[model samples]
Target: MLRSLVRALSGEVDPEIEARVRAVSQGVNELGFDKWGFSPDAVKHAMGLYAWLYREYFRVEAFGVEHVPPGRALLIGNHSSQLAYDGIMVATALLLEADPPRAVKAMIEKFFQHQPFVNVMMARSGQLTGLPQNALRLLQEDQLVMVFPEGARGGGKTVWERYELKRFGHGFMRLALEARAPIVPFGFIGGEEACPSLVDVKPLARLLGMPYLPITPTILPLPLPAKCSVYFGRPLVFDGRGDEEDAVIEGYVEEVRSSIGALIERGLSERRGIFFG
Candidate 1:
């Protein structure tokens, strides 16, 4: 097949190949291969890859995926743990849970766009710069958009700030209003557990040109084998109300923050599994 040929031609398997495979798989699954006489090989391959990564590296448990509807939806989740594993877990869960299996285009920080090969892989995987223009376009196309309003600082916060949702940016609300998309608030727990910080090394990080270096209780100080969970909240509808004002948008942002916080609390309190088990 052309896909196999393309994969063979590439000397090193890149993330873009995986992205294409995932997109094709999603399309096949949506088309109901059993009834349409189509093949789900790509989807199967992508799922297998994800399963292997998750099983080998992290234990992920997701709930409330049924909350994601078939339409333009904005997913706002708490970004904890310096590595941003929470975002990956949530995206994987959405891909696996949706009946038609929608492909989510995440809004990434501007810095990622400057990375050497990472930018290419992210673009091929449908990631876009966290700009208003791209957000509007995706919403207009009825694509699922995943955004972390707290940005990298929030996600990279120290262990002390774990589970504490930060002040959310208004961009998410504005995008929802512009695209008329329902907002889905979700929470990620145990991401910080994977990479807990033991000391404050901001000064050293500045010298090394790195953001922050977390000292965890590991031999090589890698991300701990923590049990990760993603909890999806009920959708918040726009109600056709034009952007009332900046004040109104701030109010809505607060509501979203509160909702996500509540979900995180619920997930953390109700979870019964260990990080490695």
Candidate 2:
């Protein structure tokens, strides 16, 4: 029954898209047993469903995909919504739209590893804990790594705080410098529509052991669909040892945040309508 509901929400994939997905799924077949526990089959299944949302539901528009250089880059960006639809949309765009599809390994919070089904699915989907060790290793292996510097603060915002970037952790800067990986700052224009949270219920979220428990007013449980636009910026390369002082690293981190903030502003500026991008 739950699967049926998801299928209904996702609708159907066209023949061309189906063919493309099938071809791409073949390359990552062995991803499951790999170090990251990435199950290619599971990824294919999820991608098929996300494709429906990407092409139809949110009508996602991915820009500057070419800016995502191949291999060993840090994908740093803003976060939004309770469930991470913004991140999923960016991942979907890279998988289905980018030239020569690339695999993105995102770092999720460690507490997620405690959840049963979610933990399993997250690992199988190539998500690792947000640890410096894991990030360094991924970059060393020349994989595309993603980190949400905003953490939970951005995801838990109310509608009034929409598109406003929160303070970022500087850990990603150190990791990128140590790994010698370029940092790509990206932005999403309308992810707040995924969960138009109006109330910031901090007390309840504490009871739930969540970062931020948001009271969504727009769609309740099911996320209300809105047009989503993802913009990628040119890669920023930094030269330094990984062990820089916090003050120095903060400067670099701020640069990334500012770039993403500007990108978000541009996307919002050019937006045509709420349901259309």
The TM-score, computed over Cα atoms with residue i paired to residue i, of candidate 1 is 0.78
Query: Which candidate leads the pack in TM-score?
Result: 2
Candidate 2: list runs displaced more than 4 Å: 1-32, 218-221
**Number of backbone collisions per candidate, in order?**
1, 2
22-62, model 2: which lDDT tens digit per residue? 54443343433565687665666677667777877788899
lDDT of each: 0.72, 0.81
**How well does model 2 score by local distance difference test?**
0.81
Estimated TM-score per prediction? 0.78, 0.89
lDDT of 1: 0.72
What candidate 1 gets wrong by more than 4 Å, as runs, is 1-49, 199-222, 240-242, 273-277
